[model samples]
Target: MENQRGKGLSFARRIYRPRIIGLGIGAISVFATLYPLDLPNWTWALLVFNGLVWPHLAYQLSTRSAFPYQAERRNLLYDSLMGGFWTATMQFNPLPAVTILSMMAMNNVAAGGLRLFIRGSLSQFAGVLLSWALFGASFNTQITALQIYACLPMLTLYPLAVGIVCYRLAIKLSEHKRALSALSRTDSLTGLLNHGSWKDLLHIKFHKCQQRQMEASIALIDIDHFKAINDTYGHIIGDTVLRHLSSELRRNLRHDDLAGRYGGDEFCVILPRMSQSQALDVMERLRQIFSQYRHPQVPELKVSLSIGLAAFSPDFQDPSSWLNAADKALYLAKNGGRNQTANNAGKSHFEQTQMA
Candidate 1:
C-alpha cells in the first residue's frame, strides 16, 4: 500500500505542470468563443476559476488523497467534463470546440490509455447534456479569425509541454534499465561478476589474446580450508573470509584486470597483457596480504588462498582449455601445500611456488 501511494504521488506530480499549461492556454480558446455570446457573470467567474485555480486545486487534492493515483484520475475526468461544458457554452463553435475536445482526448489517452479515454469521453458527454439542459441546445459552426488565433496557443503549447514530460520519462526509464542490467551481471555477495558474466568476459579475453598473440594470464583461486572454517565457526564467518579475499583482490589487481566469484569459495581472474611471472607476483602478494587478515568478529580466525596461474598459449584450442590449465595449476598448489601459487603454462609438469 505504501508503494502504491508513492507511485500515485509520483504520477500526480508528473501531471501537475502539464495540467497547468494546458488549462491556462485552453482558457484563451474558450474565451474567444464565448466573448461574442456575452455569457453570465457567474459563468465568467467559473471560467476564471477553471483557467487559473483548478490546476493547483487538482494537484493539492490528488497529493493529499489516500489513493493519489485514483484522485488524479478523477481530476482528469473533471477536466474532460469542463472541456465539454465549455464547448457547449460556445454553442459548438467548430475550431475552438474541436481543439478543446481533441486536447482533452489526448490527455486522457496519455494518462490512462484506452480505458481512461473511454471514461473521460463519457464524462464529457454527460457535461454536454447538462449544458444543453441549462442553456438550451444551439449550434454555431462558424469559426472567426480571432478564434483560430486563440486556438493556436492551445494547439502548440500544450503538446509541447506533454512532449517534454514524455521525454523526461523516457530518460528515467533508460537509466533504470541500465542499473538493472548491471545488478543482473554482478554477484550479490562480493560485488564481482557472477559466474556466467565472468565466463563470457573470459571468452572475449581469450579471443583477444589468441588473435593478437598478446601476453595475458588467468588465475583460479580457492579459499584454503574454507569448509573447515565454515564447520568450525559458521557460514557467516566463511562468507566474511570470502569477502575479505575479494576485497584484497580488488585492491591489489590493476584496474584493467577482471576478477569474478567462480562459485563457492573459488574466484577467477583475468590478467590482460601480463606475463606468467608478473601474474604470479601479483597473486602471491594478494595471497600474503589476505593470509595476514584477522577478522574482528572472530579474532582467532586466520585465512589463506591456493592460487593457480596459466598464461595464454597458442597451443590452447579454446577458452575451456585455458581454464583447465589454470585448474590443473590450482590442483598442484593445493596438493603441494595449501598457501602457494602454481603455474601450468599448458605443460604436463607444474612450476609451483610455495609461500614461506
Candidate 2:
C-alpha cells in the first residue's frame, strides 16, 4: 500500500508541470478564438481562471487527496471537460477546438491508458452538452491567422514535455532491472556468488582452461565442525563465522579469482594462473589467518577451516570431474583430521592452530 501511494505521489508530481504549461498556452489559443466573439465579461473571467489558476488548483487537489492517483485521474477528466466547454464557447472554431480536445485526449491516454481515455471522452461530451444548453450552439468554420499562430505553441510544446517525462521513466526502469539482476546472482548472507552462479562461472573457466591449457586450481573449503558450532553457540554466531571466512577469502584471493558460497558450511574458489603448490600455500595461509579469528560477543569462540585443493589436469573429462577431485581432497582433509589442507595429489598436512 505504501509503495502504491508513493507511485501515486510521483504521478501527481510528473503531471503538475505539464498541466501548468498546457493550460497556460491553451488559454492563449482560447483567448484568440473568443476575442472576435464579443463574449460577456463573466465568460472572459472564467477563461482567465481556467487558463491561469486551474492548473495549480488541480495539482493541489490531486496531491492532497488520500488517493492521489485516483484524484489525479479525476483532475484529468476535469481538464477534458473544460476543454469541451471552451470549444463550444468558441463556437467550435476549428484549430483551437481541435488543439484543446486533442491535447486533453493525449493527456488522458498517457496518464491512465485506454480506460481513462474513454471516460475522459464521455466527460468532454457532457461538457459540450452543458455548454450548448447554456449559450446555444454555433459553428465557426473559418480560422483567423492569429488563432492559427496561437494554437502552434500548444501543438509543439505539450508533446515535447510528455516525451521528456517518458524518457526519464524508461531510464529509471532500466536501472532497476540491472539492480535486480545483480541481487539474483549474489549470496544474501555473505555477498559472494551464490551456488548456481558459481557453477556457471566454473563451466566457463573449465572451457577456458581446456582451450588455452592455462594453469589454474579449484579449492573446496569446509568449516570444521560447523554444525557443532551452531549447536553450541546458535545460528547467529555460525553466520558470523561464515562471513569471517568469506571476508578472508576476499582479502587473500587475486582480483580475477572467483569465490562463492557452495551451500551450508562450505565455500568454493577458483584460482586462475596458479599451480597446485601455489593454491596449497594460499589455502594454508587462509587457514592460519582464520584460525586466529575470535568472536567479539563470544570471546571464548574459535574457528578453523579444512581446505582441499585440485589443480587442473588434462586427464579430467569435464568440469564435474575437476570439481569431484576437489571434493575428494576435502574428504581426505576431514578424515586426516580437522584444521588441515589436503591436495588431490595424495598429500595431506595437519596444522594444530586450534584444539577441538
Which is the leading candidate under TM-score? 1
* Residue 335 C-alpha lDDT in model 2: 91
- For candidate 2, list the clashing residue pairs, or say none: none
Model 2 scores a C-alpha lDDT of 0.91
For model 2, the superposed segments whose C-alpha errors exceed 4 Å read 349-356
- lDDT of model 1 at position 137: 87
Q: How close is every model to the real structure, measured as TM-score?
A: 0.93, 0.90
- lDDT of candidate 1 over 100-206, digit per residue (tens): 99999998998999999999999999889888988988999788999999999999999999999889989999999999999999899999989999999999999
lDDT of 2 by residue, 1-356 (tens): 77877888899999988898899999999999999886779998998898889989988898888888999889888888888899998899989999999999998888889999999999999889878987899999999999999999999999998888888878998999999988999999999999999999999999999999999999999999999999999999999999999999999999889999999999999999999988988999999999999999999987899988899998999999999999999998989887889889867854423421
